[model samples]
Each structure stands twice: as structure tokens, then as C-alpha cells.
Target: KLPPDDRLAVLLGVIFCIPGSRRAAMDDSEEDDRGPDESPKRPLKGQACRHTASKSSNDDEREDGANDGQERPSGSEGSPSKKKSRDNIPEPLSSLHGLVPESPPRFVSLEQIMTTANGVTNMMLAHEIAMDDTFKLTKQEHPEKSLEHTVKKILHQAFWQVLEDQLAENPPNYDQAMQLLQEAKETLLGLLLPHNTSLRAEIMEGLDVALVRQQAEHGTLDFGYYARLLISLMARMCAPVRDASVRDLLKIEGVVPLFRGIMDQLEVMKLDMVNFTIQEARPLIQSHSVAYAREKFRAYLETQALLSPGLDPLVHTRAWLRRSHEELRALSAQYSPDPVLNGRGASGPPFAVVLAKAYIQLLCWDPSWEYPETLSMDRERFTLLGAQVEECALVASVLLVTHSVGGASLQDISDFKEDLRSHTRLLLQGCGKCSEEELTEKLKCAASQAIKEVQESLQKHGFAPLQLSQERMLYDQVVSMASAEHHIRKLLTMRILDFIKLTLSSASVGPTKIPAGLSTLEKELTQIAGTFLRLVTHNRAVFGEVYTDIMAQLRAT
Candidate 1:
């Protein structure tokens, strides 16, 4: 067996052969034929020339593999990088053939640039070894000149190869090696400042000195050191302005708008960088994010207290939403490294927000509440019964409010109050009626007509039909609430008719006799109307001008 060092070098060279093995042997022969005056041909920029040579060699190897009846791995076709790596692995049976002394030694044609990689690594290691040897040896001339010449000669060639390796990946490991290249550009700018008229000036203008130096100094580049440097550079590049005068200028009300514009641009740039990072990490990110979300949701469901049958469905819904939001937030935090699928900010709402929203919608589609199967409403308490399904309407209204705004500002509260007052006044005036069946039927017909009129009025006010998902949800809630209110009103009207019939029968028996519950019924009717009025007012903002027009018409009737 060969010595460990030579074995490792041969191992690396063979490993990196790719498709260049055949060409390397042919090139070796051609170089031998040429006179001593002709130097070996150097690999071109970007290592494209060497890779092209490798491709030809690999095609032959692929055919050999096929002839030998080796099956190609599935999914390798989609990933050229993977396929290349797979092909680089030499077969055990092929290696055994090399042991036959009767057969000639195998001609492993590793790419020319890769063949030099070990040399570069050893050269740097030798410098370190020389430093350690200096402790024991006396004063000696440093080999800096020779070392520098060797490094300068092959530095760019090695860099292109390294870069090619980095780029040829699906989710490129762009953290350190790429940053070294970037630093090289920045360092060259500084290097140029100090050398205004040096011979290096022309080369430095187009060359990456930092990258060349980094490759030469270390046996293997320290990814950790480069990563940290990248972080610092990124921070400095993206740091907030710290100039006192500029900050003071920004604080001035007159200059605020300009500052706002600057801030907007900065924010946009930040988001773009975040999106780019997320895109690059997509391959590294696994399908586990979806599974993680499901797991979290399941955990939340397990911990929920759903044993109480007395709880209103709306109350249960609110509880569920609150818990789901919390769990979703945790899931989002877990997936902070992954790209957000819902177009939310990196730290915006949880990944579960979409899931929770869906749940809310599903629940709202068939919302249920505690209500009597048949309202046994008396004339005296008929109005109270009208408010029986008020909780359902209120719950729907609350959802609308929550969905519309994350946080209610003072202006929002003020607007809500004003709308409530206006809507309440209109509803009370229109909805109030003396308890009687015939008039109730008339009001019902009028309400139906008014509903259509309200919708038309909304269109006239330049409000577009609900198109956004949120807008549609809010509209659906409005229709549900209206349907529930209509049902209650009908039940109340029937009770009033019952009372009127009873009063007429009693009056015939005793001419001066008043119905026992006439006064009480009237009071309940007004109170019930007031309750309905408040509900209508609370939701008028969502329904818009259409609701206002309908309420106004109903009041007029």
C-alpha cells in the first residue's frame, strides 16, 4: 500500500475526476510529445474549459456503466450535481482490476484544476510547518517570495474551481465561499487606494485579491471565520443611519415625508433580501413544516376544554381561535428559516393564520347557537324573544370586527361609535310596531323590498361587490345575521297577533275590560325593537350605505 499522504492525494484526485480522466491522459501524452519550450495549457476562467473536458470523459464512463448493466438511480436526472457526484464514485470491481500487475496502471484523469487543489492545500500547510520548525532552527531566509509566486500563479484558477463547485449545487452553500469572493472585491478597492501607480494596479482593477489571499493562507478555508465576516459586512451595509445631524433633520415635521420615503425604500430592500435568502434555503427546508403545523394543531385540540355542554357555540369558537392562534404562532416561529407561503412578513402572523382563518370560515358557514325550537313567546315578553338569537348575530359581528382590524385605533373606535348611534336611531324608528299580525306581514314584505334596495344603493355609492376573501366573509355574516333577525321578527309578530285576538275576546265579555298584558306587551315590544336596533347599528359599517338606505325605508314605513 502507498503511504497515507500519497494515498489521500490519489484518493482526492480520483474522487474529483468527474469526466476529465480520459482527457487528462490524452493531454499528458500530447504534453510529452511537445518540446520543453511549451508549457502545460492552463484551465480557462470559470473553469469552463476543464469542466467541458470532464463532460466528454463522463459520457464514456456513463456508457461503460450502462454496458456493465448498472442501473441509474431515480431522481438523479433532475439533479445534475447529484448525478455527477454519483458517477464520480468508482466501482469496487473496477478498482480490483488495478491490482493486477499484468495489467497497466489505471489512467485517472482528474480535472487539471482539482489536481492542483492538494498542492495548494499542502503549500499552505508547509508554511505553517515551517513556522513551527523555526522554534528549533536558527535564523533562516523566509520562503515568502517563492510561496507568494506559487500562490499568485494558481490562486485565480483555484478560485474559479471553488466557485464552480459552490454554484453547481441545487441550494448553493453561499454562506462563506461566496462571501470570501465578495470580500475580495471590497479588499481590492482598498488595495487600489494604497497603490496609485504600482504594476499591480491594472490587474487589481479586475482581480479578486482577497479571495486569492484567502485561498493561499489556509490549508482549508475556515467557513466559520468567513461566515462571521459576512455577517459583520452585511450589518454594516444594512445598518440604520447613525448620523446625528441626519437624524435631527429627519425629526423635523417638514422633512418627515422625505424620511418616510427613505424608510419605505429601506423596508422594501430589506424584504427583498429576506425573500432572496428564503428562496435559497427552500431546498434545505423540508416538508416537515406542514407536518409541524398539523402536529401543533393537534396538540392544541388535545388541551382544549370542550367538556362543558353549556358553552355557546360562539364562545367555543372564540376559545378555539385564541388557542389556534397561539399554536400557529409557535409553528411560525419554528419555520422562521423557511419561506412563508402566505406572503406574510418573516415575523408576521403565524403560519397557522391561514389554517385558523379557514377554520373560522368553516365554522361560520354553519354557525349554531342555543335557541328555542319553537318560541313560546307571550305578548308581554314577545320582544325579549326577538332578541333570543342576538348572541349569534353578536358573535358574527365580533368576528367581522376582529378580522377587519388587528388593533382598533382611537379613530376606529370613534367611527364605530358614530355609526352605532346613527344605525340605532334608524332601526328603532323603522322596526318598532304595534303588536298585530297583518302589519307584521306588511313589514316583512317591505323589509324584503328594502333588502334589494339597500344592495342597489350600495352599488350606487361606488362600492364594488365583495371580491376579496375577507370582504366576502363579512358579507356572508351580514346575510346570516339578517336571516336570523327576520326569523325572530316573524315569531314576535305571531305573538302580537295572538295577544290581539285574546284582547278582542275579553273586550266582548266585559266592555270596559283591558287585556291583562296589554301594557306589558307594549313595553316588551319597544324593548325588543331597541335590542334589534342596537344589533343593526353595530353592524352597519360592514353593510355600508345599503344597510342605511334599507333601515331608513323601513323606518319611513
Candidate 2:
């Protein structure tokens, strides 16, 4: 018999070999079982058992040739080639050279045979139980709570149970059982080595004790379940390591194909979400615009008729803002898909909802708090009020233009604005005196005059002719799409110019202190401005005159 130390070394090598050591034995067993006509079974995924069998045959043929002193093919008659050939032979096979006897041992130990038989029986039982249909059904029903998952969870319990049983047994089947577990541990450690050597070693020790204990208790090794558990643990352990590796690799390289696929998917998801919100919000947006315009005009009419503007203007605006908030919130909730599903958050609400919320907050602010009666028309008061108004208009215009919701073209917006402007002439027509068509013409004339005056003002201020023309064209396009009251539109344009003037003025420089409530809206506006700046820079080639003017204007601010 081989000495205990040499035998242990052989066992260690066997454990280390895993599939390589077991494959030849398994193939031999299958050959013995096969009928004359039976074809070979295909190897499982990532397995090269058949190749190993072919390689073993080649090795045997070489050994036979060497025994007969036949000359073999050689790349070179060199020390390096001889050394490489010797190195290529597996350590386990080489270690057996002096250890294996010329003839098989004559005596068989009854105790050793019984222990091995019992271990084999235990292994068979565990494999059979693990392969039961109920386990498969349970796995299918609750994948996260499957036998495989449960095994991982109860790993410590199973390990201790096996360890205690192994220690308690009169004659434990530690050799066979521990070999099975060592094979699993070695396989897992191979994949997780270098990164988590200490962790893997601890797990291996626990696994070794558990396998021995379980085999001692049940008379069969739980190799199937334990193998699966080790595989799962390897995957779980490797996931973060894989991600860190990917990030490091990415830093050194161009775009990875896998990441490109992920980006493509993300882009598709973003587009789908944006399109969905636009489709849902279009009708609501149109109704909101119409309602706002109607309320503003009605309030204006009341103000004109009353001795004092009274509380009606503020009350009506507050009521409209509240109603708009509710409707927009409902629209957003209906259209905005769950962000977590896409592994993202903090995207905020849809564009329409954001604008509506900003509008409501701006309009619902108590003017008296900042502007008492004495200071109502002061420059500071007008600046703050005008800035808020301009912000609302700007946000609303951005929402409209970005999505082109409701298919509202510039012409359609112009027509809609023209219709709203008729209200001004209607008030002048005195007690419903004018026709809709006649009022429309008068409203059109007034709007044209207002636009012409603004253009002239730009020219007077030394705006380049080409730049001014382009600016006017873009303004017309944007203003035509605006759904606010005509007075609001005019005042908004003026406030923008005022803001530009303030920004350029030597009175104050850098950003001004903003209130907390206005911070969100202000941040959004800054982002929008940055986006516009980029567009102006990149598209200068196509819209050079317009972009040049816009750039000049933005830079001035």
C-alpha cells in the first residue's frame, strides 16, 4: 500500500484536477455500459471530455512507442523541447510513477470497501433527491427560493451538520466525501482566485467539513446540491469583480460593444418614454392653453370695467393655477412610466408637468409680500414680476417646441394667437359691436405693428442687419407657437430684453441670490440655456446669422 503522505498528495492532485481527473474514468464507465450500436453522448457545455479521451489515446500510443524504442517525431533535439514535453504531462500522473505498484495489491480491506460503498450510496441518494420533479416545480414557481437558492442560504447549517456527523461517526467516509467537496471548492476557487483568496479559503474549509459530516450522517455525499451552491456562490462573488474589471477596461479603450448595446437600449427607452408623455399631454396642453388665454382676457376685461382692479385678477389667476396644477399632475402621473424599472431616477416629471408647476408657483406668489402698494410699480418690483412672467413663457415655449406636441405648427400657433388677440379688439368694439373676421383683422394689424416696432428697436440699437433679420425670423416662429395672452407675450419679450440689459449692466455682476422655491425652475432654465448655447455653436454653419445673433445675445447676458 502507498504511504499515507503520498496517498494524501494523490488525493490533493485529484481534487485539483476536477473535471480533468474524473473525465477519463467517466468515459471508461460509459464505454462499459454502452451496447455495440450505441453512439457516444455529446459533452456538456464548456466541457472537452471527448478531446481529453483522444489526448489520452495519443499519450498511450506514445508510451507504447517509447517502450518499443521507436523514434518519435520531434520539433527539435533540444533541452527546451524535452523540458516542455515533460512539463506538459499532468502532475497527478507524474506523481504516481514511483507510488503505483507493478501489480495490484492482493488484499482488500472490508472496512474501506464498506465506507466507499456507503459514500457512493449517499451521493446517489442526494443526486436523486435533487433531481426530483417537485424540486424542479418549486424552482419554476419560485425561482429565487429554489432548492439551489435554499442550499446557499442553509450552507452554514449543512456544513456544521456534516462536520459534526463526520467527527461522531465510528468510521467516517471522509476520503470520498471530502474529495467531492474539495473538487467543488477547487473549481470555485479557480474562478475567484487572486481577488478573494482569503474568502475562498474560508468557504473551502467550511465546505470540506460540511461534506464529510453530511456523508457520515446520511451515508451519501450531497455533491449535486453542493456543486450547484458553489457555482452560484462563484457567480455572486464574481459579479462586482466583473463590473470593476469592465470599468477599468473601459477607461483604457474605445466604446465596448456590450456597453454600446446597453446605450442603444437606454436611448430607445428614453425615446419611448418621451413619446408616450407627449402623446398623453398633447390634448391637456391644448386645453390648458385655451383655458389660460380665456381667463387672462376675462380678467383684463374685468380690470378695465372696474373702478379698481379689485381681488378678481389675483383670485382668478390663483384658481386657474390650482386647476392647471391638478390637471398637469394627473397627466404626468398617467404618462410617466416607473423610472426604477429602467435603473434610473431623478429624471423629474415630464416637460409639460414641470412647466405647469413652475407657472403655478410663479403666478400664485403673494405679490404684496414683495411689492407693497407704495412699491408696486418700482423698478425692483417690475423686474422681479417681469422675470417671473418671462420665465413662465420661456418654459412653456420650450416644452412646446421640443416635442411639437399636438402637431401645432408655427402657422397654427399664429392663427391661435390671432384668434386670442381678437379679444383686445372685441373690448374696443364696445358691447359686442364687431364681427369675428373684422376683429381678427384688427388684432392681426396690432400684432404686426408691435412686431415691426420691436424689429425697428433692434435695428436702432445697432443690431447687424443679417443678425437682426434672423433674430426676427426665429422670434416670429417661437412667438407664433406661444399660447399665452397677447399682452403677456409682448411683455415677456420686453422682459427678456430687460434681463439681457440687466445682465450686461455694471450695476451688478454674476448670479443673483434666488429663493428656495424658485431654485428648481431656475436650474431647469439654466440647463435649457446651456442646451440652446450648444445648438447655437454647432448649428452655426446651417443657421449662422441666427446662431451668431443668439450667441451674441446669450454672451451679453
Candidate 3:
């Protein structure tokens, strides 16, 4: 080593080791898609996903290539498919074909295949884990003290006893303890920043392994001094969350125990740093995530293209866009004779319209067909989101219908509202795949309960209960709300759709406050909506060209 400033010449002295440094590195690819419902009081988790578009000529915030979090995949590379005219916009020579094969791909190495597979798997898993509403890296103390815990303690005690015996020998063998100390020094340095010059110097000088080795050779090495010094420095540097553990290190008397405490505290601090880094990176990640994910996916797509042409990476993508094109046509026909949709005016919906419709399909996706490769990472998320929407919609509709029928009679029934909401929501637990008939049955049950609760409330309050005819009319109306054709159900669904539609369009960025009338359903629905919009927004930016081509073809026809 060069000098004491060099920091690692303590060859034959004690050092510490911790497993915390082995944690998998986390990238800034998350869009804050926090989703969970263990506690209804807690809002859905994660930040709104954002992606900018070329159509907006966004001169505002640009992360990677996104502007204002609106989505436009082509950016400066290309333009969106315009409303009426197709000028300055190029057209695809042939339709996107995922079912037909053109040519077999050349041989690809196993290494290449494994590399791409790992990257894709890691990206998907990381997002899924971090998306939990209460996800945080934690180290539980004592952890119920199971048999395994006892066994681990015994093994650790035996090892420390052997180490104690070794140190007590005439000339102590510092081999293992030295290794541990070296490991600790490396870990502490890992926690430092370039600007932390004074702390770095303090750590390097205070724990100088060279000087420690010299002292050990002369029978004068003070293990407690090193441990206490490390504890002192850590107390100054650690996050407040770890302050208690650092202080507890001072209570230990034996060298082995003190060193053990030091390593344990170091691990906690290491994990603490990780969690802090993730929290700090959230905003930056949100801003650049759309573009960042696109670049990663682009690289993966190219690799797949070269490896296996027969296995088109975008097969589901083509199918997804095709469905949107069909939807756009149906929508246009449904509102025909309108100048804008007929191409006689400039008010027609752009690719954003088609894109919104496509995302809506995810709410009730056919489970048999694999989700689009572009959205494969979010299949589980979209499934849960579908349930949240249906749940919110059902809850709101039930309450609205209940109040209408129970009017005045159940006016003072404060507890009835909460009761109805809880009962209706309970009927929908794990209802991701409920059939149309099953849903109607659930709604019928909800209707009966509403009436029962209303009668009980009215009788308890000494008010006249509803007449039989009134109950019959109320029951029929509530059950009918189960059908998609019903006005209230359809209206609520449309409002939910509008919320998502506006959220996806560049014209409606920062739509945290939605339109009125969805007050009861806004909390949970908004969370899912923000995540869905962001995922779709980033996805659209990545596949904007494919969508633009499909839109152009549909418009031309």
C-alpha cells in the first residue's frame, strides 16, 4: 500500500463482512404503479405514469424524450397520423402481419438468448415487486425466533467461540478476524460519496489496517478500540432509522460480540441506503421511465428480431392494434353523418382515441390469448386493475341506487351506507373472472341486502317502511343496473372511460382532479387509472409508429 491514506494495508488484522452488499441493483425503470387493497383506507399506490408525444411539439420537460409525460413514440423521428389530411405522414406498404411467416431466422447463440431472457425477466420482476403499495426493504428483529433461528444462533455461537479461542492463543491468529475487518472497511467505503472527503479520511485513518496489524504483531492491538471507533463514526453517518442499533453496539463488552454487533448494524445501514436511494430516485424515474423503458425494450426487440424472426416479438402488438382499428371503425359508424368522423371536418379523434379504446379492452381481456408482448410485463397488474374498476363501479352504482329507493325513509341511516358498501364489496372479492350471469346474481344479492338494511333502519328510527310496490320497483331497478345496457351502469362506465381517455391524451396532462359525479369512486379508481394511463402512455411511445401506421391504414380505407 502507498501510505495510511491508501486505506487497505491492514493485511494480518481483523476486518468485517456483511451480505447486504450483494443485493441486486435496482434501475430507474419504475412508474410508481403501487396497487394493493389490504386496507381500503389506503389509496392505491404509485405515481402517475407519463410519456410525451411528438404531436404536442413539447418544449416543456423532456425526460429521455418524453415531454409533459404525454406519449408520442415517434417524437422528432416521425409525426402522428393527422386528422383529415395525410400530408407529411408516410404510410406502411403492407399491413402488419403476425400470423404469417416470411423467412426463418439465422442461428443465435445460447449466450445471446440467455442474456436477453435475464434482462426481460429482471425488468418485469423488479417492477412487480416494487409496485406493492407497502413495499419496502426491511430487516425484522428477532423474527419470531424459530427453530431455524436457534440453529443459526448455535452455529454462530460455536464459530465465535472458536474465534475467541484463537485470539486467546499466545500469538493470536488474526486470519479470519482480519478478513472480517477488511470486508467491513470495504462496505463502509461503499457507503460514501465522492464529496464526503472528510468522512472518508476519518474512516480510512481510524480503521487503518496496516497500523492495526503492526499493533497486533507487538501484542498491543485493542479490538474494542477499533469496534468503538467504527460505532462512533457510524452513529454520525447512519440514517435516523438505524440510530438505535448503532447505540446498542456500545453495550457489548466482548470483542467477538462487539464485532458481531458492528457487522449487523452495517448490514442495516447498507439496506437503509438502498431504500433511501429508491425513494430519492422515484421522481426522476417517473419523468424518464417511459423513454428509458422504450430504449431497453428497443434493444431487446432488435435482439429478438435477429435471433428468431419466426417468433415475432410484436405478435400480440399487431393483434392489439388491429382490435383498436376495428373499434375506431365501429365508433365512427355508430356516430356517422357527423362531419368530423366522416373526414369532412378537422375535429376527428387521433391515434389517442384508438389507443384509449385498446387499453380499455384490458379490463376484460380474453384470458386465452396471451397479452400483447408490449404489455406482457403488466398482465397481472391489468388483471387486478380490471377488478378494481369493476369493484368501484359496482360499489358506486349500488350506493346510488340504494339511496334513490331508500330516499327519506333511510335518510337518517348513517350506518346503512357503510353497511351497504362493505356488503357489496365483499361479494366481489377475487372476482377477476366473474361471468355476466354471476355478476347479475351478485347484484341481485346486493339489491336484496339494500332493501333489508333500509327496512331495518326505517323501523329502528320509527319511520314508515317502504311499501311492497316501492320495494319491487327498487329491486328491479337495482338488478337492471347489472346489465351493461342500464343507464346508471353505462354512464358510470363511460365516466370511468372518459377519465382514462382524458388522462392518456396530451391535452389533459396532470388530471389529478377529475370531473365531478365520480366522487365516491375516485380514490381507488384514480390510483389504477394513473398507473394504467402511464403504462399505456409509455407503451404507446414505444410502439407509436406501429399504431400510427395502423391508424393511417384504417383512415385511408
Superposed Cα RMSD, model 3: 15.9
Candidate 1 clash pair list: 19-54, 20-54, 21-109, 430-555
lDDT of each: 0.35, 0.38, 0.64
- Residue-by-residue lDDT tens digits, candidate 3, 510-541: 55556454675566677878788766766676
Off by over 4 Å in 2: 1-56, 67-182, 209-232, 240-557
Per-residue lDDT tens digits for candidate 1, residues 26-70, read 232121112233333332223343356776677676555544333
Per-residue CA lDDT of model 2 for 66-181, tens digit only, reads 44343334563536877789789665553575776343213323333332333332222222222222211011122576885576447534544554565456765454335434
Order candidates by TM-score, high to low.
3, 2, 1
State every prediction's TM-score relative to the real structure: 0.16, 0.17, 0.63
Q: Candidate 3 — which residues are off by over 4 angstroms?
A: 1-172, 327-350, 407-453, 456-462, 466-495, 502-519, 522-528, 549-557
When summed lDDT is taken over every stretch of 10 residues in candidate 2, the lowest stretch is 131-140
Give the least accurate 10-residue stretch of model 3, judged by summed lDDT.
9-18
TM-score of 1: 0.16
Off by over 4 Å in 1: 1-264, 275-287, 294-485, 488-557
Top lDDT prediction, candidate number = 3
